[model samples]
Target: MFCLVLHSHLPWLANHGRWPVGEEWLYQSWAATYLPVTAVLRRLAAEGRTRLLTLGVTPVLAAQLDDPHCLNGMHHWLGNWQLRAHEAAGMPSASHRDLGAREHRASAAALDVFETRWRHGGSAVLRELIDAETIELLGGPLAHPFQPLLDPRLRAFSLSEGLADAEARWGHTPAGIWAPECGYTPGMEIGYAAAGVSHFMVDGPALRGDTTAGRPVWDSDVVAFGRDLEVSYRVWSPKTGYPGHAAYRDFHTYDHDTGLKPARVTGRTVPSEKKAPYDPELAAVAVDQHVADFVDTVRRRLRSESERIGGPALVVAAFDTELFGHWWHEGPQWLEQVLRALPEAGIEIGTLADARARGYVGAPVELQDSSWGSGKDWRVWAGDQVQDLVQLNAEVVQTALDTIDKDRDANHHGFEGDPELRKRVHDQMLRETLLTVSSDWAFMVSKDSAAGYARDRAHKHAHALREIADAVASGRDEVARRLADGWNAADGLFPALDARRLPVRSAETAAFAGSTQ
Candidate 1:
């Protein structure tokens, strides 16, 4: 049996009143992926196929999915997609008119049911699938931290809070976590063990202590599964993934005339206007071919391994869930069909937990700090453009420590009723802190995708923390109130952040290492 792990996650883009980056990203992903993916699973269940695959949906993403504001936004976005598709279908006889009609109708129907089930509280359709055992849901830390780069206490608090939130909503605590970006560092196993995580997924290289994929590896207490890069990469190979094939819709090129996304991925280097129209028949053929190639690859790898190890070998294929409906367009359909085809051809599909149950453990070893970014280094977060934010983070982190040390002791009057609020503050601080620390920001800066926006957000969060520290320092209620109000205005996602419970450190840790405060 091959274990297929789909990690679905995004940061908390809530009703924090932020835009162009935060909550909008959540709604966009929801419309493009979440609702569609769930619908796909529901259809599979109806076909009598017992859907038992592992999925890691981060708490931050789940929280937004369940948020009243986000629910409303997604409902609106889905409707807009339906209308847009409808409008596109009416345009002049473009090559993609038929495809547009089918897509528009399907999207409208799906949204109609999704809105009906998402009753302002819980996503009933998703709940139904979970109850039916079609999908195995997993949860990860709040804000999806690059764990290996996080402070020890911060890591514990984030994982603990995330797990608790999962238990509250999903009715079961996840036994495994998908480290954000598979960012693994030495000693992270201790954190996973503390969080009660029995297993976590890492890249193939992280397991072998090298990029070569010859064997599976494990830590002292946690089991690590590597993505079967050969099979997994086939669907989205570096250059010639299914998305870049000639028959499928081009993700990058959009038609400005009708506001419809109508370009096809002609061969590499072909301009958008020169490409052919998206032909569903041709795409179906491509999906079929890719599916066959993927199945054969998995079968060969597993059989070869079984021959060597004298047992039933497992290949774990992992991917970002969003890559399905959003990036690849026809990705969700391709996945559903591929899932069925693979099993029919003798390739068994299993979850991470299933692989572990079959005694697929590896030799114990420590992992190095890393991410799935370019060069797989820490430069993404700690790079030059984001240096100011890093310095600001250190400063505010120190200020938070000093506040805790000086005012928040056994006799602290503000710690009692404020724990939840304190927790909110701590969590939000951690969130912004993590966001500011995200390797993506640096990568984006390097790639030049609104670097100013990323930099501003990073520093803004740091500034908010400084204000919080100042309020605590003066014992002036008005100052704290104003700063809290400002944060509330800027970020309404976490209203319960108690300014009092923010962690405090000793004078030494509070003091700057090389720079003066």
Candidate 2:
């Protein structure tokens, strides 16, 4: 069985900068990836495909997709895409005119779809597919924190809250999760069981590369599905992938005047100015060949893996949802064709939920510290270069936990204080703290991809958290309320989030956590 997983996620970028980094990241993914990807799923579902794949739209991304601010901003961004296309039409270069004509058509379709269907936000589209059983939706923590380094109490709280958030949007609480970075700790399955998560993803090496089927973690019913890198890398890999094909549009080569990508990836290391113009016909041909190649690769792997495992095998090829259309302009087309072609090639395709229900599961295994990042270990998040972020996360999380517990101990519901104000203070404090714990900050810093912005964002949220916590500690109730209210104006996404709901661990659990990392 072939189970494809697409994890859709982005850090909260609502009030962050626009160009060069923040909300621009969100808008670009929304327009270039989310819109087209969902459109493809809907088209396939219309053709009677059910349980085509497992889609994990992280809770943070889901919140933004449904937010009023993001919805309005997305509309404006689509309008801007059309304007840019029009400007490209008047450029003197024939390649510029061709690119303009193509983009104008694409942008026009995207804009109309945005206005008619997506104005309410992406939940409407995803919810429809979920209800139809077209795909299995997956959930993750509210802010996509690296669970391995997070405090156990906060970790459980994040997972439970994230599942609840998904239910609110999609009308289905996911039983599966695309664990942030596919990061795992030895004892995490206990938290997963508590949160009612039956399955989660892990790197292939975690299961000793015998990722033929989902393995139960330890003795619990919670299962960990490992990504089959052999098959997955055929499409996307660090060294090479179909995206680098010469016929595909070069993501980095752009019509600077119009901001449209107009060149093909003529050569891997070739400069953008020297690249050839993108040809849709050539791209279509490449897509066909790649699709055929991927289907054959999966078939061969399924046959070999099944024979090796002494039973039918499960091959899961997972990737970030943004890889489609956003990074590889032809990705959505490739995806649609692959889903169609796989079934015809005699390979059964289903969601992760289907694979589990069909008994494609193995005996319990003791998983270890792992992530799908570099080296397939915790170094990407906990490496030396990012030690400061690791320290910041540790300190802020501990402080937030201590402050919340102290508040409860002090007033037993804040009898001597404004109860509503106290709750708001703690809620916003936890919000800021959660934002700080996002894995993106350390990732950006380690990779030097907007390291400065990542640091500024991390510090900004850290400052908000400290300010809010301090006001309450100083008996400044009104000041605390204003501080939380102001922070909510920016970091607002999970509207129903409550600090009071955050899990309060017992002494035994806390001591265990202290003894570990």
Candidate 3:
């Protein structure tokens, strides 16, 4: 059986900004990726396909998708997309005008879909798929933090609360998770087991290069499935992938007038101005060829592994969900074709849950620290290039926890005056803390992809946390309440988040503390 996993995630960006950054990111992804992807899944479900694939929607992203603020913003963004497409049609360049017309129709269709269905929120759209059994939903930590770098207590709390959040939205708790960036450390299995997570994904190297089947981790029944990089990278890779095909629409080169992509990826070395105009017919042909090639690749891998293991083997190919319609315009179509073609090719399609339930298990193995990022290690997040951010994260988390612990202890004995106000402050502190620790900021800084923006976001959240903590500590009740209320209105994502889930200091440790002014 071949299990395809798509990890869907975006950092919490609600009310952060709009053009070229925050809300725009959410809307572009929604119009291009989520709407079309869900439409494909819905079509397949209507045709009675079950357990088609596994999708991981991080709690933070889920919250943003379901937020009324974001929903209204997305609606406006789609309307703008249609207006831009219409404007493009009047461009002097005939090629640009044709591309504009095509985009206009596409945007119009997407707008209609959003208006009729997604006007409510993404949760409603995803819940329909879950109810239809079209996809197995995988949940993750509250903010998609790098778990290996986090404090164990915070890690446990985030995982538990994240799972609960998923259950609250989807009616069913996920039995598995696409661990943030597939980052894992040796003892994380204990946390997974504690949180009732039976299965999770890891990079191929984490399993020491053997990814033919799911292996029990660290003597626990919790299963860790390794992605088959050989088959998976055929669709997307840094150097070469199907998306780089010459006939496909160029992602980087945009028509300056319309802000729409009108050129094809003529060649790796071709300059944007020199690139050829995109031809949808040619791109369609390429998608078909690529889909057939992917199906054959999976077939070969499964057959070879089955022969080597003396039985059927599992071939799991995973990728980011955004890659489909957002990064590569034809990717969603390619995916729909691949999913439908694989079944006719005699390949069994199922989710990770279905794969595990089918008894595709192996012996227990101790996994190494790994991530899906470059070097498959912790360098991307905790390396020297971003050492300052890493230290800031550690200090911020500790301070936030320490402040919460102090408040909880005082309130426990009725010493701290207003329990309700303290609780509100604590919840806002956690929200800021989680936002500060998000893996996106670290990753963007390290990769130099919007490094300044990433730094500002991290520092902004940390600053808010400090203000609230200091206000609460100084007995400035009105100041703390106002700050908390402001932040709750601005950076709010997880409405149901509870600060009590955070681990408190041990009694022995707390006894050594004295009241401070």
**What local distance difference test score does each model get?**
0.66, 0.90, 0.88
Root mean square deviation (Cα) for candidate 3: 3.1
Winner by TM-score between candidate 2 and candidate 1: 2
Two-way lDDT contest, 2 vs 3, winner: 2
Query: How are the candidates ranked when ordered by lDDT, highest leading?
Result: 2, 3, 1
The parts of candidate 1 lying over 4 Å away from their true place are 14-24, 92-100, 119-125, 209-219, 383-386, 410-435, 438-440, 494-517
**Pairs that collide, model 2:** none
lDDT of 2 by residue, 390-428 (tens): 888887887788788887777686456554343778888
Steric collisions counted per model? 7, 0, 0
- Give all TM-scores, in the order shown: 0.87, 0.97, 0.96
Residue 126, candidate 3: Cα error in Å is: 0.3
Clashes of 1: 7
Candidate 3, poorest ten consecutive residues by summed lDDT: 508-517
Report the lDDT tens digits of candidate 1 across residue range 1-517.
7777788876555554445566666766676677678777878888877645788888767767777777877777677767777777776776546756876876777687675766464435556766787776667766676666555555666677777777777677888888777778777777688788877877765655322122233346676677766767777755556677787778777766545567678777898778777777788888778777777887887888778767767777788998987788778877888788888887777667766776777556566766655556666655676566556655655555555456446335664556432434333444445445544455556667767766666677667776666766777556666665667555554333333433344343333233434
Instruction: State each model's C-alpha RMSD to the native.
Output: 3.8, 2.0, 3.1
lDDT of residue 290 for candidate 2: 99
lDDT of 3 at 270: 99
Q: After superposition, how far is residue 117 of candidate 3 from its true place, in Å?
A: 0.7
Q: Looking at candidate 1, what is the lDDT of residue 283? A: 80
Model 3 Cα lDDT, one tens digit per residue, 9-124: 99988877876778788888888899999999999999999999999999998998889998998988888878889888987878868988998999899989999998988888
